[model samples]
Target: MQINVNLNGTEQSHDVEPRLLLVHYIRDVAGETGTHWGCDTSNCGACVVWLDDVPVKSCTVLAVMADKHRVTTIEGLAVGGVLDPVQQGFMECHGLQCGFCTPGMMMTARWLLDHNPNPSELEIREALSGQLCRCTGYHNIVKSVQWAAAHPATVGAST
Candidate 1:
């Protein structure tokens, strides 16, 4: 299958297997390894990416299904060498420990802030329920999202 997609603001086309998972296409073909591949069963949000501006588990999506759509990975979160607020928040709040789930956590957090700039701690927890992080116990992760919320200017500019 030949799929064309707007990846991280760049138009890219690739020939891939119909059954190829979007995560593989992004990592292998697109050369964007920032979207981590974890738990192929989709239980882990490590493969989360923005498909047409909405967060979806790349592991669960077929590469062909992403044809003609826009996909944004962690690499796209920053612009002009400046980090997005969510990324900065993660750093400032020490959101990640093992770093395995950081990419997905940030992706989901970015989406949550895009839709709801002022999410409560409970709301932030609920939004990230699908993503599991064995490290940090989610305390700093919640604070990370809250940090991004408080700095709307940075996040809004990145988007």
Candidate 2:
């Protein structure tokens, strides 16, 4: 199948099987490794990506279904080699550990902040309910989201 997808703000066309999952396309075909694959069953939310500006678990989405859609991975958050504020917040607040789920978590956080720029601590927790972080215990992750909320101009800039 021939499919086209806007990935990381760039257009790409590739031949892929209909059964190929969006995460595989993003990683293997599009060469974006930041989107991780934790649980193939889509329970972990580690393979989350923005499909046309909404977060969806790529593991459950077919690449062919994403044809002509805009997909944003963690790699897309940065602009001109500058880290997005959410990424910076994670770094400054020490939100990640083991680095397995950081990409999806930050991706989710970016979506939340974009829609709700001032999410409360509990709201942040609720927004991140789908993603699992066994490493940092979500303490620093919440702090990072709070930091990004405070510095929305830096993190929530339109792409």
Candidate 3:
């Protein structure tokens, strides 16, 4: 199958199998390894990515379904070398531990903040409920989202 997906802010064209999962297409075909492949059953949110601006678990979506659609992987969060607030939040608040689920968590976090700029702890928890992290127990993750909500995105010092 020939599919064209707008990845991040760029267009990606690839010839892939019809049954190829979007996650595989993003990682294997497009070479965007930031979107982790985890839990084949889609129980984990590690495969989450923005499909046409809405976050969906790529593990459950066929790559062909994403044809002509816009897909934003974790790599899309940053623009022009400045880290998205969610990405910076994770660092400032120590939101990640094993680093396996960080990408997806940040993806979802960015979505939540976009729709709801200032989410309360409970709302943040609810938003991230689908994502599973074996490390950090979500305490810092919630804090990370809060940090992002406070910081937002602006051009300034990086790293």
Count clashing residue pairs per candidate: 0, 0, 0
Q: Once model 2 is optimally superposed onto the true structure by TM-score, how far is the C-alpha of residue 136 displaced, in angstroms? A: 4.6
Q: Give the per-residue lDDT digits (tens) of candidate 2, residues 1-159.
A: 999999977899999999999999999999999999988997888899999999999999999999999999988888877888899899989888888999899899999988898998999999999988868559999999898888776643255
Clashing pairs in 2: none
TM-score, every prediction: 0.96, 0.96, 0.95
Q: What shift in Å separates residue 129 of candidate 1 from its native position after superposition?
A: 0.3
lDDT of 3 by residue, 1-159 (tens): 899999987888899999999999999999999999999878889999999989899999999999999998888888778888888988999998899999999889988987898889999999999989977559999999899999975522121
Question: Which stretches in model 1 have alpha-carbon errors above 4 Å?
Answer: 156-158
Error of 1 at 107 (Å): 0.7
Candidate 2: stretches off by over 4 Å: none
lDDT of all predictions: 0.89, 0.89, 0.88
Which whole-number lDDT from 0 to 100 does residue 4 have in model 3? 93
Q: What are the RMSDs of all candidates, in order?
A: 1.3, 1.2, 2.9
Clashes of 2: 0
Which scores greater on TM-score, model 2 or model 3? 2
